[model samples]
Target: MSNRVDELEGQVAELRAAVNGLTEELVETKDRLRKLEAEAASEAEPPAERETKSDDHVVVVEQEQDDVDVATDSLGSDTASEAEPGEAAVEPEETTENDTNKSTDDIIVA
Candidate 1:
């Protein structure tokens, strides 16, 4: 009976030590998980902040497109005004008098 009690006590002490070790490991693992989560959060930027940056980029692109369109329109108007008025005129083939009066040199001028 005495030997059996001693064996049982030894087993109980070993089990208690194992439970303590498991509890300590669990606490450490939880701390590590918390630290990892915090690091991940610090590295990440919020979606709304990223969207604001993208919105700024979109505005800049739109402004550039508007400037380019304005510049092209002004350039086209300037070139059109610079063109000679007589050269800008388009006549139909049915305008018989002008076609007949045209010199051969002028007909092939283009």
Candidate 2:
């Protein structure tokens, strides 16, 4: 009877240690979650404020036209040859049954 009691006590001790370890891990996880939520809250702005701030900011981006042409040409797409430097390629409009009924006056020129 004493041997059985000793074995049960050993198992209880192991269980206690496992429960303690799990509790510590859970606490650490909760702390990490709270920190992350706080950081996210600090960084986020209200929608109205964000929109107003975005309107006040102007972003300009510049890239060389030659670099674009080189990348396109390397990809083996015939786009580079279709248009000359400083010119845009004009595509011919396809004539469909619906399009044929539309008058030329209805088309707007840019």
Q: Return the clash pairs for model 2, or none.
A: none
Worst 10 residues of 1 by lDDT: 47-56
Per-candidate RMSD vs. true structure?
A: 19.9, 17.4
On a 0 to 1 TM-score scale, where does candidate 2 land against the true structure? 0.41
My TM-score estimates for the predictions, one after another, are 0.42, 0.41
Candidate 1: residue 13 Cα off by (Å) = 0.3
- Please identify model 1 stretches exceeding 4 Å from their true place: 48-110
What's the TM for model 1?
0.42
lDDT (Cα, tens digit) per residue for candidate 1, span 1-110: 99999999999999999999999999999999999999999998744212223564463223345567888999999999899877856776566666668754366643
